[model samples]
Target: MPQPTGPATAPRAPATASSPPSAPPPFPPQSGPPPQEALAPRAPVPPAVSEATRLLCVGVHHDRAFREAVLDELYVHEERFPAPSVGIDAGRVLSHAVRARNHEVGWAGGIVGLWLLGLIVSGGLLALALLGSVGLVVARWIRGSGSADTGVGLVRRAVAFYVRWLSRLYLVYLFFAVVLAALFLGGGTFSGGSGFGPGLSDPLGFARLAAFLTLLVLAGIVACVALRRGQFARVVSEELSPSRFPHAQSDPAETTAGPRLSHLRTRLRAEQHQPLVMYEEDWPFRGFGTPFHTWSLAIELRPRGEAAPVPLDNGEILRRIVPLVEALRVPSPRKDPAAAAAVIDRLRELRLDECVFLPADGLEWRNGAPYAPDAFAAHRAAALEEGGEARRHFLRIRVGGWDEELVVTVFVRVHTQGGMLMAEFAPHVLTPVRRGYRLAEREARRHRALSWPGHIAWALVHTPSSFGDSVRTLGGWLWGELRRAFAGYAGAPAEGPSAAVRELGTDEDLSLFQEMDLDRYLKTIQDRVAGGVRTALREAGWATDEFDQKIIHVANGGVYIDSAKDSAIGIGNDNKISHTPGGKGGGKK
Candidate 1:
């Protein structure tokens, strides 16, 4: 036999290429974490040694390309196959290549020429008539006097106009053909009388006309379909217009060299004597309107048996799935804390471990705390509400392994307008197929429920009093007490807004946590301040003799000042302090 191809060497030994330096031989797996060496990061391979991995490391982490790639793969895979299977490596390779080359499928004038020629050859005079009609429509509908045949911009606009006109023309032709055929056939009969009626002449002409009409209608339909396909091509072209069209396919045989899945599969295959399948699926976290940005996959680890297939139940399989989940999660500018936590819960329910894939940013916060995407979509608002404005996005993932197979799903949601994308994987380890789907229902639902009111409240309450935005700032002691009461969670406080109930204007003391202004902002500063001062005096700390409390209102700000010894005490002169700015109690105003 011809000598083996020298391990298909590419700088490093095949075993070392994929496996960690300290890990056991990936071919024959080790029990129990493969030692600490297996967990250790692999030495950096030179860019020339393996460009794919190098590019993947940089590309996926930097931009949304890898994230979108996974989503696109999952959606396509789900569409093509039912109950997803990643049985063939060729399928995954082909799908990946298709997505990779999606942007490059351009009309190089040759394709356009072919299409035009096809139109002429196929439609002949009818096609010419349609083109003439298109020209007329373009002239009538479009604004510019200049010919649209010159610049790319003009050409595009002209093409759009032409296509739209062609579509309408096709519809009209189809309608006339149908109506005419009905009138002739129904109103006349077999070349007698009125053809369709009893007094008509020959109907053969009508028949031929109908046939030609049918043919024309079909041609228009075909052209419209082709045009839509081109539009899809254009969308892909727009998405992948970046300068770098780098391929991110990781080699399976290389341990730490390429994508983690590739190496893990190689090692698992070496250890087991059975066939395997692996794939992924995505789950959305944000409300319906946002995109499904996070994903999880389930991998099947089945082994061959005489009676039925058996799956491996190794703990290491569980261990490896965690990293795979982590790898699927791509960083986006928009992120929501509660939604993210919900994603974690969903992943755990799916049995994919969450500890391995936790975001570097800590997830803990008070009830109404906002996070990342909130930071990115930042806005300035003038509303006198306690809560500041916030924007949210979501990402979720799910992964699992079953009987010689692996699966994963990633969902990505960005912004309030909500662009959602999902990635799913089928369960075949050898060549796990990836696909993607857009989350439409999820996208719509989020927009409806997102709380613009609550965001304004949070902003108003969170902003400093010096900003002259706090509604209760002038309410003095009463406002202070109320504000303090509201500061705690809605449930614990003795007096404050109640929780968010669906009904309008009823209960006042349930809990106001996430709900916007359940207890309402102070209605009038005069009444609130008078009430607050009385409450504060009842609570003591202020003596009329030693100090004086006076309310001062200027164009710059309103202040509660204790004017004693010619100095302001209770509230700050600069308007920053809420109460007792000079650290002394005040006399009543």
Candidate 2:
């Protein structure tokens, strides 16, 4: 929302660490009083300008932070130059009067608009004529009545006041014209008794209506022009008035306003150069809670030039762009439990884990089916007939909080060729569970980064239990490393570089991991492991001698890992390094 602007009568005093010295005394009285005091004295010093009153003159819109900053600046000025006891504080008094006068002008314009609207329709032209004449008479009275005596520069103020309202009247005229035109055009059927539309019958009536419409349009244009011209003139005159306060400078193009606006622009321009600040659109998406997306932004202060674009890091850019891949995304718009199963099954074939799945068959096998021990034996039996890569056959279920429940029924088909698979999952019907599954899938992949080779080969799928555990353990280690690293980086804050460490560790919210480059690093590690595993499998004679096959899985931000099951017995070489399933703490096999 735009900020409000106007005169502030009571501005809060600024808090200063230390108060300044007292103000100087006022000017000494002139020698001879005499001449019955040439003309009357100006109104006993105009009210002092409060901090708020000074700000009102700027007329610039300000957000909460901006407003506070401005107030602080104002307080600094006052502290540096306090009002003296002698000849009133001229600057303070003038600023106060200027703001007050501006406020009065605003009120006067409102009053004139009200009067014109309330009386114009009922009294017609007579009312306008009366009001105009009355206004002229008052103008004359104020000009002639306020003599050089009363000492109030009241005449200049009066003139300013008059023009302020006069401009408003022109505005009202423009409004009235628009309303009249709308009514004339919209009220097409004259009255209930009229047989045809108002355009029929007497041709002269139509001519008169056309001419009246044209006149109204022309009058509106003239009123608008006059308003613009008169407003500018008033603003210029107000600014020139010796009593005016120091506020912002007016826009160069805005002849209608005073320098107060200009001052405001100057201040804003100065502030924009102060420093660079980082802001988050919102908290990163929380799993299974209110869904949100995370992205990083950087803003630079004191820009080298007027048009320089802020530079963004690579990870930050990807944070915003990686969600478009279907391979990396989940099934969506599901309706029922059955639909959810279909989606889950299809996801499995594509290696996209839409939801958690537990094997319905024996626990020793993967996805409820044990791997065949010998390809040659199976081939001779021809028991496993080849099928299209897209066919999927997997038990599908929705994953819940550390639990599972049977909701829908579906058989997913999968076909594998050239180390890639095509799969599709379909259900008999749609249900709400399907919708929930779709949403979950989408949330999981919203920021999935699939730039790695493994990502291109297979989908990365995970069960809730394993995912939570991996996140917790990996986060701890990664953060610990970062903190240890930053401890030696120079020019760092005394408290140490902890934002990176803190953010990486203990962030259960998976969205953070996606938005960051941590996943890519982890994938790199997984890729190395898979490569080493494949080399070992090639040594065994059970699989192809070539190390080209890639493993597939549904991973957060889908990816691939070569399968060891099909190649375990293919290796025939003896030169190799001993290895164990676990790394860093395990012994060689």
Can you write out model 1's per-residue Cα lDDT over 61-131, one digit (the tens) per residue? 22233423432332222211111211112222223333333321232122333334444543342343344
lDDT of each: 0.27, 0.28
Estimate, for each residue in 1-589, the C-alpha lDDT of model 2 and write its tens digit: 1112221122335545564545333332211112323122211112122222222222211111222222222221221111111111223323322343343344334434433443433224324334443454444445663345555667655684685467447435744664464345433333544644444234433433443444443343334333432343343335422234323233222233357534533332232211111111121110111111111111211222345434422222222222222122233555564453333221121111112111112222111122233532443223122442221122222111000111112222233334332332222101111122223233324323334443322221111012122233344434434644564422221110101100111112223322222234223323432343333333322242222332322123253222211111111123122221111111111
Using all chains and alpha carbons, the TM-scores for the candidates as numbered come to: 0.19, 0.16
Off by over 4 Å in 1: 1-155, 170-174, 185-209, 212-589
Q: Cα RMSD (Å) per model?
A: 30.7, 36.2
Model 1, residue 407: distance off in Å is: 20
What is the number of residue pairs that collide in model 1? 119
In terms of lDDT, which candidate is strongest? 2
